[model samples]
Target chain A: MSDSRVSSVIQEWASPFPGQAHTMHPVTSGQAESTGQLAQMEMMPYGQSQLMMREGGEDRVAEQMMGMSYLSYSSSCIGNAPSAASTNHHHQSHGNNEQDFSHFLLPTLRAPLTKRSLSKDSAEYRLRRERNNVAVRKSRDKARRRIQLTQQRAMQLQEENQKLQMRIGQLTQELDTLKHILSQRHMPGSEEGAAGESRI
Target chain B: MSDSRVSSVIQEWASPFPGQAHTMHPVTSGQAESTGQLAQMEMMPYGQSQLMMREGGEDRVAEQMMGMSYLSYSSSCIGNAPSAASTNHHHQSHGNNEQDFSHFLLPTLRAPLTKRSLSKDSAEYRLRRERNNVAVRKSRDKARRRIQLTQQRAMQLQEENQKLQMRIGQLTQELDTLKHILSQRHMPGSEEGAAGESRI
Candidate 1:
């Protein structure tokens, strides 16, 4: 469990491998593989993902990167806020069909909440707090990574853009030189324009 | 409240102005201004934000885009899991200082939760569910917009790349024609070699 947690932290932070700093870092092989896959998955470039989306004949890569599982609300709740409210009211009246309810429902109902024990001292509150703490961390980490990855991808594209522009400039200069040589040689009255020499 | 909600929804989704779709849309002037600001804020390109980050001597743009407010956990809870656990234990001892506590604590502990109404039928549960529903929508919309923005950036860069490549090709072909003309004209023995017309 501890190794998995460490591995997940590395993946979430996208931190450089700690093994580089500490040569003897004790990581299980499974932990290493999982972390490696997550890093690879996130580090995939935006252009490459678009290509993959086209090649696969679907947007699975884009969907996966968007964290589809976390965002997958029922279609009923997606765009229609009015419908979502009505759905909530529907559940309020027919509470028996609670299994289909979303994150709004408590995950486990081992025991009902009691006002007397609702104080922070109670075990239930502690359990709930612990669970929420984990959730908050997960959500925050996910958002932070998304922002970081977007920035990284943007930087990559910017560098590529610069390189392509430079290439165009170089080609343009070369073409200009070639055209200057041709103009010098093809001057009808200046047949002896220094044979093959052009200032350009 | 409803107008604010709709304006916020527009900002979160970064959807095109609805006024474009409904000519008679009833948007208050203030709502229109707020939505316009948010749209402008989010539509700022990644490169422009990076430049702003540099000029401002801070990463305010990046921080804002990352939704720093939502993710700002106390330092105690951020990275040090063990410290976070201990912090929770400390909170358990000092329940009086609940304000410093994060989302784990109920936002408003009205009369305390009692076991009887802990079921879904309670007004407390309904209120909590509604608040959570709003939060869920806000978080999902923010994430979806982030993904869309990143993809939009990638597409922009890809198109730029293609244009640059095409320019290079044109330059290269032009250069080749120039060189062919120069060679044809500079041929010492071929003085009448189509002086200005080399089939190029």
Candidate 2:
């Protein structure tokens, strides 16, 4: 149940195959509640052709990420609140030139940046963050489920394969026994002779 | 492959499962050559329990993303160049109050903003973006390969299952035939006589 134990298991389960060098960055922002972020990032590398354990570790990681997101979101909002002058500066700096638009003739319908800062402090930014967070969570859960299903399917198939091999051996042995009996009944110069031969 | 055809296939391959309402946002920034960004974004939704064709379409999409990154890097650099005054403003605006650091006493080592703006125009920003683009590409390709391998494994298992079932049927038939022959030899009043009954 401890974070360290879960984190270590996750690290092993998700280590990249040799030579790939797929470095999964842990969530390193020093927040005590940020245990889940590392797991989320770590899981990204499990898409490699390695067999990862989807047992209890993934469930714990998922919970951790869910808890971490709330804290991270709140902290980010506090740190990134834009001031009035900074918002004004951002608006004045982004200018429009029709000449720059000539190359890509799409409709320029977005209103000027002055009307809304779209800063971390803004309502729009928070809304977008909320939506993105939900999307990311959904995506992660779907991925975990897929991996679990694949593992189950693989195990089922392997069992089936073994059963098939055993059945093939059984059939071969029975066929041999039947052929031997027929041969015994139809011996070249035995007591049952021609009658048994006709039957065979 | 034309962009439209690939896009249609991708859209079908990655449509969210019923009731999930997972709306995947396409790359809407209209630049004519920005074909790959949509595919990249679309692939994220494929982690759901659906069979996606990692055929010609994926290869095209990967190429498109690689191509698009160069253009995006170039365009973003041009648009986000920081001004001298803005750099100064950013430095002055970000204050260092020791009180704010009391809650989380980590080393605050990043220098003043004026030392390096880290804007889209900055070399540091470009380097980071370049690294991120490569990491994303690697991650995407690995995911695609995993999906393909899963599909292949599933098919192989199904085929093996069928073969095993056929073998089981064949063995059952052979066992039945041998039993019938033995029964005929040991009948109550068969012409084979008491000698056959002794052998049985």
Candidate 3:
């Protein structure tokens, strides 16, 4: 009866504390190869169960020692209550699932919470936000200034082009007047020379 | 008296035809060198003399042949007439100056005349003017199209920026709601667990 109680307590702790119990299980010669394979798996990068080993190593060892005493008490309860092991396993799994769900939700929830927790008056966050705001404002102002300058430059170019076109027109007109005067001078000279020669 | 009248006729022709007046007095080596130098000067690119040479080569040469015969006659008519050699030199220099001025003005006047003579009906001139007009029109159209395309591109980018800003705002709001729900769930669960343990 005592041995059955002890086995029930071990089974209960094993289900919840897989990492510890799995590591502590006695290895017989027949199970040596399977134990080696399990150890290899634990060393892999995907072995998240090993993470618990890194935290509270000494405290967990002490707890495990204390758990032996608790085991005796639980075993007494278990012998008297046969349904206790399965019920505890069911509750433990449910608690673990809830914990996993909470872990998954934490990061999603943390982002906005951290943003909200940003103290309105704190210098660090306020200064950073203000710096970003100032940079944006300065860039907008610079862009506006550039646009105005471009418009001014375009206006200046247009005025210069108009002046050049006017100058070209004036030059063209002057050349035409010069040509007309030259032709008039040539016609009289040629006509008088012809008449004089015909009379001679 | 007949010889004197014949000499008068010959004098008139020779006065205008310098090249043919060698019989009156053979062209001195110095005068010939000067004449050759004048011809070289007349050939210069910017001078009016070059144009007269090009336009009246045959006429001027014929007049020069007549002037030579006239100079011989003039020498016969009045043995006291100015030295044929000196007379020839003076006339050549006078002709050089007149030819130079004409040559200079002709080209200056011709360039604009050519432009003016481009009648709206002349195929070759019209084609050249039309090609220039087409090039200018194409450049203006290209510039206008480029400006329009740039404006359209800027508008598209602005629209995209606005959409991104809206998406960021929606995501931020959703995160805030999720965080509020998670915080509420966590607080009440801890409180209920404490109450249940106390009751137990």
> Considering every candidate listed, which one attains the maximal lDDT?
2
- Per-residue lDDT tens digits for candidate 3, residues B170-196, read 544443443343344346455221111
Give the per-residue lDDT digits (tens) of candidate 1, residues B1-200.
11111111122212334233222212211122111111122333433222111111111111000001111122221111111111211111232332422335574542222221322323443455445644653454454545556756766887888888887777776666666666666576664543332333
User: What is candidate 3's CA lDDT for residue B200?
Assistant: 6
Q: Where does model 2 sit among the CAPRI classes?
A: incorrect
Per-prediction TM-score to the true structure, in the order listed: 0.33, 0.40, 0.19
Rank candidates by DockQ, best first: 2, 1, 3
Clashing pairs in 2: none
Which sections of candidate 3 miss by over 4 Å?
A1-122, A186-200, B1-200
Which residue pairs collide, candidate 1? Answer: A113-B115, A114-B114, A114-B115, A115-B113, A115-B114, A115-B115
- Sliding window of 10 residues with minimal summed lDDT for model 3 chain B: B56-65
Model 2 agreement with the true structure over B18-115: per-residue lDDT tens digits: 23222222222112111111112222234553333322211110001001100111111112212111222221223332123233433344322223
How would you encode candidate 3's per-residue C-alpha lDDT over A26-124 as one tens digit per residue? 111111111121111111122222211111101000000001111122322112222122221111122222222233566655333323222222343
Query: What's every prediction's RMSD, in angstroms?
Result: 22.3, 19.8, 57.9
Residues A12-103 of candidate 2 have per-residue lDDT tens digits of 21222323322222222112111111112223324543333322211110000001101111111112111111222221222332123333
- Residue-pair clashes per prediction, in order, are 6, 0, 9
Show model 2 residue runs off by greater than 4 Å: A1-125, A191-200, B1-125, B191-200
Which interface RMSD does candidate 3 score? Answer: 58.7
Sort the candidates on lDDT, descending order: 2, 1, 3
- Model 3 chain A is weakest, by summed lDDT over 10 consecutive residues, at A57-66
Model 1: CAPRI class: incorrect
